[model samples]
Target: MPQITFLLPDGGTQTLEAGDAPTVMHLAIRHDLPGMPAECGGQLACATCMVDVPEDWRGRVPEASPDERDMIEDRIGSLPEGRRLCCQIAVTPALDGLVVRIPERQG
Candidate 1:
């Protein structure tokens, strides 16, 4: 299982052990983590599942896809540096101890 740390805008953190679904969005939704709407249901069509991976943790995770890149460029208030669509990333052991920050607001 990958242990992920989610940092909220309010200066709080929630750590979870995730292994079932592949994406971070799935993990958040599974735990009913506050603010994880996943309105698009893992589709790149929505920006509601944006999360920011820390600079140090970036290499441990996969880079965004071309579609995801376009979404970030197109959507307002999209995730900033190190931001990624949770739906676009999968759960992997390499991401263990990953720390990601949720934007104050998402699509």
Candidate 2:
């Protein structure tokens, strides 16, 4: 299992122990953390799972898929370089201690 740290908008952190299967959105919802809506249940159609990857780890993560990129640009607001759909990020041992920042707002 890998541990993930979510930095919430309120300056609080939620640590979750997630196996290498569930997406970050699933982990957040499972732990009842705020800021992640996961409204479409991990589907890229929704922007409710949008998050910002930490600056230091920006390029470390894979580039967003075409579908994810399109969805982010169309459904979500402007896409920052590190912005990603949480549903598209799979939990993995390599992602242990991954840090994600929840955006202040979601549509």
| lDDT by residue for model 2 (1-107), tens | 88889999788988889954478888888887788888889877777898889888776677789889888888765678888988898887878878999988875
Alpha-carbon lDDT, every model: 0.83, 0.83
Q: Specify the highest-TM-score model's number.
A: 1
The deviation in Å at residue 9 for candidate 2 is: 1.6
lDDT of 1 by residue, 1-107 (tens): 88988998688899999878788899988888777778889878877788888889888788888889789768864446798889898998888898989888775
Error in Å for residue 38 of model 1: 1.1
* Candidate 1 clashing pairs, residues 3+ apart or interchain: 22-91
Clashing residue pair totals per candidate (backbone < 3 A):
1, 0
Candidate 2: residue 41 Cα off by (Å): 0.3
Q: Scored by Cα lDDT, where does model 2 land?
A: 0.83
Task: Tally clashing residue pairs in candidate 1.
Answer: 1
